[model samples]
Target chain A: MQYERPKSLMDAASLLAGAKGSAYALAGGTDLLVIMKNDDFDAELVVDIKSIEGLDEIRETSEAYTVGAAVSCAALGESTMLKEAWPGVVEAANLIGSTQIQGRCTVAGNLCNASPAADSVPALVAAGAKAIIVGPNGNRTIPVEEIPVAPGKTSLEKGEIVEAIQLDKRAPQSGDAYLRFIPRTEMDIAVVGVAVSLSLDDKGLVTSARVALGAVAPTVLLVEPAAEAIIGTKLDDAALERLADVCSAACQPIDDKRGTIEFRKKVSGVLARRAARIAFDRAGGK
Target chain B: MSAIAVSTTINGDEVEFLCQAEETLLDVLRERLGLTGAKEGCGTGDCGACSVMVDGRLVCACLVLGAEAEGRSIETIEGMANGDELHPLQTKFLEHAALQCGVCTPGFLVAAKALLDANPDPTEEEIRFWLAGNLCRCTGYDKIVRAVQDAAQELRGS
Candidate 1:
């Protein structure tokens, strides 16, 4: 197979645009290699964009936190600013595989892979993350929720690559957390994952909330009704129960080896409640 | 196919080589450079037998492309000792009887070196967490954990 290492974004884009047959962008190669080995994918050419300088940066500006597509999960987990500003984001990155996998796995790859069980997608969706897509057509921002249309499918067109993930700069008077239920601890995919972000008013009432669930459907789902169940409430046991019920009802999980549909639905509710509780605590709730 | 030119410091020696487009670091280290200290127990990242340090970061060699190591410094199990004198971790592993089969020893040594280099004084829990990537099938990891602790103490005393 032909391998192309482009040193500039435009160069990479031009290479992608000029490619004739099957070609794929090599970010960290954590996921791509596995797919390639399984005989599930065949690529005539592989473009290594990692040599492009400035693509591995994690920059926080007055407006938003922009994390490059090539930034590894280990880098994200170790970023103190990211942990403080977007705790859920940090937690999501940390939850991907293990330290060894994280050393080479990129957040962009995780998003681009578009696995229903991707640990970072729900958290990013909950945080209202946006993808900066770059191509010959120019750069544009797409919502994280819109990036994945189905399991193992992405909205990215040919010659398009994710530049970075952008999150709002405003540190909400809120807390966020991600929790997943896996059969094994160290190296296992999530059976059900839940990410919650809650903004609390001064009086300890939840002013706004976002609840996202993973592994329970074809795409990482944002349960708006579940979030609305807790927003504007004190987030006490009753509100949490209502929210859990909504989350359980929202999922359309299928029975798989990892878990049964009934188990996933039940665990989804439990995880949603638990993550919401942690988020509420982090938001300085009583 | 474009051959990628990689120039890096391996085992304290500055070297340059051309790697095939699809070659992984594990393949280059084992086949091209003949630094077979890093073993590929599993081509996937699950098994840590192919652990190595790439620019001060402990990573699975199998997961990283050879081209990714360009301009980076790498330390393998072969680089641990200074001539005959073994590194503190290596000595401790020997003294503590950390390995039974010796297949996972190299990876454990490289991973322990990384941990000690980062935190000279790490708690047992920290050691366990840091070494979680490296797995030992023969030695239930109790002796390995003790060896790492002893190595930390010895390195700190020196």
Candidate 2:
């Protein structure tokens, strides 16, 4: 095995593209190191991209906020401007692991790990986030939901790397929130996760919204019907009920020791209602 | 695999070591550098027994590769005390009987010190949440929490 800390994105991409055996890009190493320790793991090259400039910064602009791929979750929680703008995304990213893990984990890593139960992907999807990718062919941007194709795989090409996750600036009366059900208080994976982002009009009616669910499918799901259920309503009981029903109907979960499929479907609705309520309140609604 | 020569700072001293690309910082610290303060409880990030500070941020040493420690500053439990005096958290732990088998003491102390360094006056709930990653099976967390509170108060000199 060989480790190369490349100072440039192209250099890192080239290294990964030219590797003979199994290769990986090491950002935080929280996941890679754990996987490397497995008996069946076979890794030949690790390209450390932390040495790349601007890859560890959280850049805010008039249009959007760009969180570098190597940026730690701890830094995201500490960014006052970013937190105030998108609290749900920050909270979801921070919920990945403990303080120690948060200090090392990255949202890009969480997305790339491609786990259906990843804490941050649902929130990012609900927030309508986009990932900026850099590859040998050049740069391209894609929706966060489009990156994950399966449980443990991503759509990223062999030489492509996600440089950052971009979130557009929020309009007035906009708020987002993420909630998950876990057996324990902390240090456990999500059983069912829900994230809701909504914007309210002057009349307290939801003008726009996006709903996402996790741990209930092979990949994080963006349920359009769930979002459309509350589009023009004030999130009253009927609107919320429709939203919950849509969320519950969207679940295609597997029965595991953590939860049964029926339990996941039931909780998805419950969490959607609760999360939408929180998002409604945050959006300055009554 | 070829050994990577890494030059980094540990406990405020410049240090140089040779390690394999696959070797973890915990392995290097315990096996090579003779700094066994950080224990390998799970060899995974789930348990914080191998907690340490890389570049002043708390992280699990077992989850970080030795090669990645190049040019970074690390703070382990060995650096928690001065030449002959123990840190307040250590003293408070001894006074409050915060340890049972003493295997997790180093990790707990390191993690608690990080919490105090960031927030001088953390509420009880905050302290518990901050130390949630470091598990203590033998001793219930009540004594450990009390010791951290006492240490924080002593450090604040009130």
Candidate 3:
């Protein structure tokens, strides 16, 4: 095996473009090493991008908050602006594995891994996050919902890497929350996860909402009907139940050792209701 | 496959090596540098037996490549003592009987050092959460948790 450590993004791009045989971009290697050990990977070249400068930045601008691909989950949890503006993103990042796992796991790796049960996908989708993809052709922005085509698959072409995650600045009275159900307390993958973001009017009426679910489908799912069910309402128990029904209906779960299809479907609704309730409370609604 | 030359600071001393490109940090530490304090309980990141402090952050040495440590600082369990005097955590672990078979001691020591370095005073819940990655099949973790708590107080002098 050959390892290439690129000092800059351009250097990484050139190295990736020139490499032959099964080469992969190493972000944090939290998932890569596992895949390799399981005999599921066949790579002749491994490109290490950690030495590249300017790719670990977490910056906020007037338009969006840009989190570089190499930025660790610990860094995301520590960002006050990110926590204040989009707490759901922070919470999702915090829930990845454990403190030790979060120390090295990056958001880009989580998305690139493309697991249906990824904890951060639903939150990113709920916050209207966009992925800045860079390749030899140029850079292009794609919505988070469109980045993953299926479980363990992405839309990224060869030599392309995620540059940063860009989340639009939300409204003043908007808030987001993420909740996940896992068998164990820590270091366990999510069985069901839900993220909800709501924008409220001055009178505490929900103006707009976005609901996303994970671990219940081939890819992270955006249940638009679930969002619509809560919008234009005061988020009472009746509104929450209707939203839960929509979220449950949107799921296509499989029966695995972690959970049964029926259990995942039922818990999807439960998590959606819990997440929506938290989002509503954070949006300054009763 | 070509060898990669890396110069790094390990245990407060500068070290140079010519390592394989595919070698992990854990492999380099054990094979080349003869620092076997960080054990390879699992080649993957699921187990934290290979935990070490790299650039002041606790990371699994197994998940990081040797070439990635070209210009970084690392601290393993071997670095936890000073000229015949053990670190406070080491002392407390001995006093509190924190180990039994002792296969996972080094990883726990390094992880505890990281936790104390970041937060001088951590609550019980914080300790539990921080050390969740390091698994100990022996001792049931009751004594280990008590030892870490005792070590934190001893380090804090409170």
**lDDT (Cα, tens digit) per residue for candidate 1, span A9-94:** 88888788778888888887888776665655667788888888988999988889999988988888888988988898888887
At residue A46, candidate 3 shows an lDDT of 82
* lDDT, candidates in the order shown: 0.88, 0.94, 0.88
Question: lDDT per residue, candidate 2, A206-267, as tens digits?
Answer: 99999999999999999999999999988899989999999999999999988999999999
Ranking by lDDT: 2, 3, 1
Distance (Å) between predicted and true CA of B5, model 3? 1.5
Displacement of the residue A98 alpha carbon in candidate 3, Å: 2.4
Candidate 1 achieves a global lDDT of 0.88
User: Which sections of candidate 1 miss by over 4 Å?
Assistant: A39-41, B1-3
**Candidate 3, B1-158: lDDT as tens digits:** 67999999999999999998767899999999999989999887766888898888888898888888889999899888998999999998899899998888999999999899889899999998888888899988899999999999988999
TM-score of chain B, per candidate? Answer: 0.96, 0.99, 0.98
Superior by lDDT: candidate 1 or candidate 2: 2
Selected candidate, larger lDDT, 1 vs 3: 3
lDDT computed for candidate 2: 0.94
Q: What's the number of clashes in each of the models?
A: 0, 0, 0
Docking class of 3: medium
lDDT, candidate 2, B32-96, per-residue tens: 99999999999988889999999989999999999888999999999999987999999999999
In candidate 3, position B100 carries an lDDT of 95
